[model samples]
Target: MPSTQRKKIVFTGGGSAGHVSVNLALIPSMQERGFETYYIGSHSGIEAGLIAGLPNVPYTGISTGKLRRYLDMENLKDPFRIIKGVAEAHRAIRTLKPDIVFSKGGFVSVPVVLAASLNRVPVIIHESDITPGLANRIALPFARKVCVTFPEAARHVKNGKAVHVGAIVRDELFSGSAARGRAFCGLSAGKPIMVCMGGSLGSAKLNRVIRNNLEKLLPHFQIVHLCGKGQTDPGLDKKGYAQFEYITEQLPDVLAAADLVVSRAGSNSIFEFLALNKPMLLIPLSKAASRGDQLLNAESFRSAGYADVLLEEDITDIRFVHAVQQLYHNRGEIKARMKSHDNQASLRTVLELIMQTVR
Candidate 1:
């Protein structure tokens, strides 16, 4: 029989689905093994509603904000916010007394990670980007195990503890059938499909550029476009374009059916594309993204030959068409590469490592 002492695991981080999905992926496995789980995120971030009402889990929120590039009058108020977040996080940690805290890095993770460390709770920090984010960098030395999605990220973390676990993806990505996926979206099996999703919120630039070239895109391929609520211009409400605010439950189905995926270089989207063995055209947002990790992630995927990378500033109608055509025509190579590149054991390996560290 197992010991009476409970095994508690706390996962922290949220803003984008990219940061939070890994925790969601890990939950089932940990629960099956008899571990109690808790989640910590920000009240203001995108994860609030998603975490709410989930079973066998307690979700808590801390006040957090991004560290902006240009100093503003608002910057003066941020120190107090950070202090408040740290205090709230410390209180949460003291209450939970988790066996270990697994953090997916972001500004939201920083204060919680710091609080966990101060309270002497074992911390596991996972960096899902090709390059680690600022919060990850700040908290790296404190983590007992620093798990990375890419080998390139290892150099930045001062710890010899950093281990590359690839990316933790839901099993649905690997199990969905392409035929059913096509039928569900009303896309033709005979025609190739192109999927463009900008994480959960979607990408405005991808939406705009693709909208500008929709006529050129539609003739050759069926389109499943997720134009984030912010990105859906009225211009895109037309035929042959399956537009969406988000496709939470049906995402894997749409992805599996697509021959090629056009997306931002966010780690979650990139890894999911790789897992599904779908060829991809990666359009990375410019240096505008808080940490500029997407730029590096896009370049890494491009260099690996699984996808093509296009810079936001450099993208144009002709170049976009040419890149899409190039990928479409030679997709066999990309598909072959994706089949050969396997990293599906990341979640189990990471969870086991975390449990071992706590033991």
Candidate 2:
């Protein structure tokens, strides 16, 4: 049986929104269930900013390093930073003395997981991608159970720790009002709305393509471009287009107002879009920049008839425009398939499983 006393759960994830998104979904729910939630992340990553928006969730910033795939001069320096972070995290874990730690697989999570293991606290890690990231791979052996959004990821987890919990989208995402969304963006009901977001840092490739081809798209749909921090164009303004640096409280409404979506195929966002039955034109992050996880994520959805993939290398103005047109034309069919597929298992399972660990 779960404990009757109020428990505490420390969540650690950062670097990008994908890493922190699951933590965001779980924190409020955990708090409501009488678990005090605290966050540990890098001082400057996107996580700090996102967590700041949520009241009552105390955040602790630690010294951490970015885990890079390739050799770089900074690689030598990062090792020391990681060591310092681990020491700091261990001290923090000892001070807080939480019952359990939940990690969402970012570089900042490494030290926190190590600290949790050192403190003999059970750990839960959520992997959103099919392949385990370097951070998650490092922490997996120490974790009690690893929850995954993708079933195929189970094979990659050793020691029988993987639990296929599906995707845990926030409950508030379903409560957004389209009228409020339209009002927030200054877009009206005369034309259909197409929302484009390229993950937390925004996509330069996506922003450029959409902006350059707006003339072709504007006649058909109003565009709400979430063009990351400092990515918006002040010089060029269009009648039916709106720009935001990055949205927090307004995201649900914006998503509610979208008739179609053009986005990067990070597992968390795509799954949320899937749950919302939003047909996506996915432009996965290219292999050169990432470990090709997004590429795999996009292909899996495409094969399942949930979304259409547009590879970064193959993107031209003509191809980009056609993909959006094709997605809109086939939106009804895609929505029907999405509605039929149950994207509803993760939140409850993960919540129950994590609490069970502490119990």
Residues 1-359 of candidate 2 have per-residue lDDT tens digits of 96576788999999999999999999998998988889999988999998998877899999998899999999999989999999999999999899999999999999999999999999999999999999999999999999988888899999899999998898889999999999999999889999999988998989999999999999999999999989999987899899998998989999999999999999999999999999999999899999989998999999899999999999999999999999999999999999987867678899999889988
State every prediction's TM-score relative to the real structure.
0.93, 0.97
TM-score of 1: 0.93
| Model 1, CA-based lDDT | 0.84
**Worst 10-residue stretch by lDDT in candidate 2?**
1-10
The best candidate in terms of TM-score:
2
| lDDT score, candidate 2 | 0.93
Question: Global lDDT of each model?
Answer: 0.84, 0.93
Give candidate 1 regions above 4 Å deviation.
Answer: 1-3, 177-180, 183-186, 288-290
Per-residue C-alpha lDDT of model 1 across residues 1-359, encoded as one tens digit per residue: 87798799998888788888888788878888889989988987877766674688888989886765687887888778877998999999999899999998778888899899899999998889877777887888789988999988888777488898998897767767778777777777888889988777777778778888989989898888888766666655666677777776677778778889989988987988898888998888788664688888988888888898878888999999889999899899988888888776898789789879988
Candidate 1 residue-wise lDDT at 57: 86
Relative to the true structure, candidate 1 has a C-alpha RMSD (angstroms) of 2.0
